[model samples]
Target: MPSDVRRTTLLTVAVLVWTLAGCRTVNRGLTEAVLDGEHARQWHIRYGSQSFYSLGDEGLAKIEFEGLIDRERVRVRYQRGMQGQAECVADVTTRLIEQVELRVGMTITTSTTIDLLRFDEPPQNFDIQLTVEPNEFPLPLFVRAGDESCTSILAQNRSYPYVLMHELVETSLAARAGGRVLPDVGYGWFGLGGSVNNYTRWFRDGLANYAGYLACEILSDEMDCPECPTRVAPLLHTSPLSRLATVRTRLFSWSQSSPSEHEREHYNAALGLFLLIEDRFGQQTIRDILADVATRETVDGRDLRAIASQVIGTDVKQFVADFEFPMIGGVLTPVTRALAANKGLNVAEGLLLEFVEPDGPADRAGLRPDDVIVAAASAPVADTIDFELALLRAGRPASIPLAIWRKDAGTIDVEFPLLYPGKD
Candidate 1:
C-alpha cells in the first residue's frame, strides 16, 4: 500500500483497539504508547538527536512591546533577548490580527496580551493557554514559556514567529466564542449527562486547531517558499486526521489527560473534523458552525448536532457517526481475533505493526509490517504501554532487541538502534 494509506490503516487499527478494549487503563496506556512512538519518530526525523542548549541568564531576559490592532491595544512579550526575534514575533502578531479579522469577519475590538518564554529542555514544541473573564470582550492568552528559540528545523530556528501566529489564531477564536465566561458542560469522559459534553468539547477544540491551520496556511502562502521553515509543514506532516480518528474512537474511554501529551491528538482531530466539514458542506458551513457556537449560552451535543444538521440540511448525528467510525459502516468493530492470536506468544504481546516508516530505525533493522513485537529490549511488551516503558528503559543510543513473530518465519529477533546516527 502507499505510505499514506498504510499510515491511515495503522491509525485505524490502533484506534479500534482503544475503542474495543474492555479495560480503560490498558487501552489508555496502549494508545499513548502508539502515539508516543509516532511522536518520537517524528521528532527524531525533524530535529534530529541533537541535545538542547541553554541560552543562559542572558537568553532568559524578557523583552516587551505594544501595538494597536483594530484600535485595540495589544501587548507582546518574549524572552529570547534578541532584537530580531522580538521583531519577528511583533510582526507576526500584527499579521495574525489581520488574518483572524478576515477569517472571522469581525473588527476584533478587544485588547489582547501575548507572552513567549523559553524552556531549558527538549520536547521542543509550543502550546497556548487562554484566560477569559465573564462578559469580557478580549481574552488574555499565554503561550506557556517554551524553548522555542532554541529549537531548529531544516538547519535554522524560525519557530518563534510561526508558533506565535498559531497561538494568536487560537486566542482570536476564543475571543469570538464569548471569551472565558462561556459555559463548560464538563466535556470529556463521563461528565454530566450523556455524550453531548464530550462531543461539544471536541467541536470547540477542533475549531481552534482549524483556525491555527488557517493562519499557518496564510503565512505559508505569503512566504512563497516550499522550504521556508513555516509551522504549517510540520503540522501537515503530523497527520491530524489519523490522530483524530483515535480521539473520536476513544473519546469516552481513554483517560490520559496531560495537555502536553494529548493536545496534539485533540488539535489534530479538531482540525480534521473542521476540514471534513469544509470539504463536504463548504466554507460557509464552517462559518455557520462558529456562529452557532457564539450565540449559544449553553453547548450540548443535541444543540451542536442541531446546529450542524440545520447547516447541512441532514442528520448531523449520522454525519458525526460516519466521521467517528468511518471504517465499519459507522459502527465500532473489534480486533478480538488479533488479540487472541497473541495469547500463545511466549514473549510479550502487543499490536502488530502493519507498516513501518521506510528507512526508519525499525525498517533499517529489518523489522517489517505484520511483525508482532512481543518484547522490546528484553522487557515484556504485552501492549503499547509496556512497549513504551521498555523503550524508555532502554534509553537513547542503545541497541534494543525486539522479539517478533511471523506466520511463516516463526519466532525471530531484530535489534533496533535507538537514536541512530543520521536518523537522529
Candidate 2:
C-alpha cells in the first residue's frame, strides 16, 4: 500500500524552478544565507509529497532536518494532517566551528536549537530570528536540561536494569540496515544495474531484522542476539530458531508468494552464521562482519565450506552434512545432503513441500507428490517452510509459477492457476 503512491515527475516545472533559482544571483545569495554558513550554519531541509488517501483526506509524507547537534537527545517533532501537508520540527545541539563539511555542504558550528516548519505556509510565520554579527551571522545556541549548549547529556540513572533506549536504538538501526537480499556466493558486494536491484533485497532484509529482534527478546535467557542459530535454538525453551524454520517451511508450502526454500534457508543460514560469529567473537562483530562481507568477497572468496574451514579451523564437511532444516509438520530433512548431490538448489536447508488441495487449480494443473516445487511465479520457493507461509499470506487467487524437479524429467517450469485454498 505504501508503495502504491505514484511519484509525480514534473519535468518542466522542476526545470523551470532550477533555472529561475539559478538566474538570480541576489536571490541565490539570500537563499544561500540560510543554507550557507549563516545562522550558526544550521538549516531545516524538508522533502515530502501530497496525495489523497482512501478516506478522502490529503495524505502527507515528509522528512526534515535542522541545527548542529551537541547533545545526544535529538528531538524531532512530526505532525500529520488530513490535508496534503505535514509539519516537522527538530531541536539539535552541536559544537560550533568556523567551517565544517557534511556530505556535500559546507557548514559552520553553532550551538543552537533551530525551530523550523514546512508546508505551503508563509515565511513570516516560521522565520527564525538571531543576533546579527558585524561581519558574519552569529549562531543562536540553546541547551536543554541545564546544559548551556542546548545539548546537555542526561544525568545517568541506574535505577532500572532495562536499557530500553539502547535496545531501541540498536534494533532501529538493525531494521533500517537489515533489508538486503544477499547473494548465496561469489563476491559479497551488492551489485546494481545488472538487472537486479540491491535495495529491493535490502528491504526484505529489514523484515528479517525485525524477526531477529523479536527472536532475541523472546529467547534472551537461553540465547542472546549474537549466538549462532545452532547454538541459540538449542538453548531456547521453545527453540525460536526452530520455530522460525517451521514457519518459513510452512509459508513456502502455501499457495502464493515469492522466495524459495533455498533462498529462505540461505537467509536463515546467514543469520545463523552471524549469530555464530557473534558468539565466538562478540555481539558487535555480527554487523561488522556482515558489512565487510557485503562490501567485498570473503578473504578466500571460494564458498561457505572454505570460509568455515578458515574461521573454525576444522573440517566443515561433516557439519554441513549433518545440517537439517525443520518443517512445521515436525519433519526434519537433510538439506545439505540433497544439496551435496547437486539438487540445483540455492540453500541447503529450510525447504517446504506444499501439496495442492484436492481438485484445486494446482491439482488440475497436474502437480503431483514429490514435485519439489522451487518457486511460485517470480517468488523464490526453495523449500516447503517459507513456501507454505507465503501461500497463506496471499490474499487472493493468483497464477502461480513453479520450478519443480521431477525425478523422471529433472528440473522444469510449470504454471498453474492458484485459487485461495479454502475458496477453491
Model 2, span 253-290: residue lDDT tens: 22213356434444444343333333345444334333
Q: Give the TM-score of candidate 1.
A: 0.45
Give me the runs in candidate 2 sitting further than 4 Å from their true place: 1-58, 61-75, 80-240, 243-269, 276-309, 315-320, 324-424
Model 1 steric clash pairs: 48-424, 49-424, 117-146, 118-146, 119-146, 119-147, 206-270, 349-382
Q: What is the lDDT of candidate 1?
A: 0.50
lDDT minimum window of 10 residues, candidate 2: 153-162
lDDT of 2: 0.33
Best by lDDT: 1
lDDT string, candidate 1, 132-161, tens digits: 442222222223243233122211334433
Candidate 1 runs further than 4 Å off = 1-74, 77-88, 104-177, 180-199, 229-237, 244-264, 297-301, 324-424
**lDDT values for all models:** 0.50, 0.33
